[model samples]
Target: MKRPTLSKKIDQLIYRNHKSATTNVIGCLVLHAIRSEIFERFQRAYVGMANKESSELGNLPTSPMAERARTCETTGERLRNRELAYGFDLDYKNDPPTLVPCTWSKNYAIGLYGRIGLQCYNLQNGTNLKFKRLEKHSTKRTGRYSSVYITLDATDPATGSVCSFQTQFSNAGSHLRLRARITWLTFAARIKQIPNEPIDDDWDEDTPGINEFYKVPLPKWFSDERGSKKYYVPESELHDNDWLQLLMEVAFFSKANRRLDAYLPLELNSVVVETLEDEPRDKLKADNAIFYISYKCCADPCSTPLAGDHRAVVRKTMDGKPGHMCLEVAFTKEQNKNEEE
Candidate 1:
């Protein structure tokens, strides 16, 4: 007779583990505690890293030596960011100031900052519009979808002005248009700082050195017979073991213990209103303004309108719900009808 397979064995273990009501509750609680403890540690580590990265360099006097040193250090010190404008220090005052080709740059990592909102006004038309939140239907288990959306809105009298808000170039070069200026904050993932360099030469064969890294004590909930395998624990409730393992491995090999890093996409902070100008698009005669407002994430699929399993689609529906949102597959019977026709 063949022995039981690994999957079957795991299933048996799970069933056995949850067989008793008391044991199941105890196991979940223990697992939850372990996860929470580990997450606190990870967060502390990340905070440490972030604090280290945001450190200000020693004040060096302005001189040729300093300039030359900066140039030399830039190769490693400065981040190789493609969407440099996505940082806190950007100047969008000048129209279309050197945008990063409207693409997501991998040099930066997107993280949870908070919700963002937008508003615009057209002085010429005496109208204004407000944006509604259109966030992804996220759950603790799914982590969080990096992208967020706002439903385009306007005052009742200003309704007609927002009709073409979704279309590109619909508001370009319009008379006395006012738009808000906002900054985007993203973290440079590739950039790492070693606050203190390790002395590799000092470690001898007899010395434990970096090789003697301490392992985090995992709770008894980790055992195969201790917890349910079918249910997934959310990151907020428990630190993801895989992520923790990766961090541990990196710290061990790089000798960067206690070093933490995080992406603080607080770059989108500036909120200013600016007047518009009539450009070539508007000069073309009869049509909507040649220039429309556009918002870019600058952290996703590196192309126009960051691509993902969920795409940002602006649709006018008669549902009569203001800023109502949902996820569904895009399909229509028109395709079949067209084929038959």
Candidate 2:
């Protein structure tokens, strides 16, 4: 009897192992079927060519046959890489955690004091605009952090826009400092409107709109440690402006075995603000510029004392006041204690 098709064989194997099979077992069967199908196709082609060779001269393996085998091997390697990149490990039957992008606005800023909130204004804006969160294991080390990606989307007041980005967080010592790297794809074009002189090498002819990246070092006081550090590292310069979109990669570092309890700011005061003079008398009227914001919260190390999904939100305000924006975090209450301290 002809050998069963790879699909049929896989079905039989699955049925047989259904009762006691683990995820790894299923993955093995699936991979086996894939390899078998490829090998079978190669064999069929080889037989056809061998038959032709016999008709013309004599049955023999040609150089082309070896090349075909090499190609099949290369294809298998690529499949394996793809499987690993996608976190498709069957050995650990646990369902892979779903990765979802998180966006948070000023409204979600919780438990932050006035001084701390002001420092995160622009960073929060960048976060709320367009951000993504993924549980990324450190390729260099065993520790894991919630990798958050962000992109710049300069939407017109009437027309809305969306983009994808990332932010990463880790623990340093007693302080939690965040490093934000922005990737601008289409939003680079909007940078021209700003009066500030663009860096000489900001954009190139072949460069896509604002493919620039920036690293913003968050204040150290935001961590459990009170304002210990005087100043943070300077923000990194953006090198490209050809891309229309922007990306922000933020890394939040805290003490070992500790989660970040700080909140991001929403007001422009944190970075820049415009002052207005009252009409009747020489009075100053200050208002917090409002902007749309959204975000989500997640932890890393996969299995830790306080690891799970956290609260995120999007909000807007017209008040241009300078103050703290609090967020209601949904993680361990101990984190809140850190904030209060």
What C-alpha lDDT does candidate 2 achieve relative to the native structure?
0.27
* Model 1 spans with C-alpha error above 4 angstroms: 1-27, 46-50, 53-341
Q: Compute the lDDT of residue 238 as modeled in candidate 2.
A: 22
lDDT score for residue 51 of model 2: 51
Model 2, 300-340: lDDT tens digits are 53534333332211111111222212111121234446655
* Worst lDDT 10-window in candidate 2: 241-250
Residue by residue across 133-183, what tens digits does model 1's lDDT show? 222211111112222211122223445433312100010111111111111
What are the clash counts of all predictions, listed in order?
Answer: 11, 54
TM-score of each: 0.17, 0.23
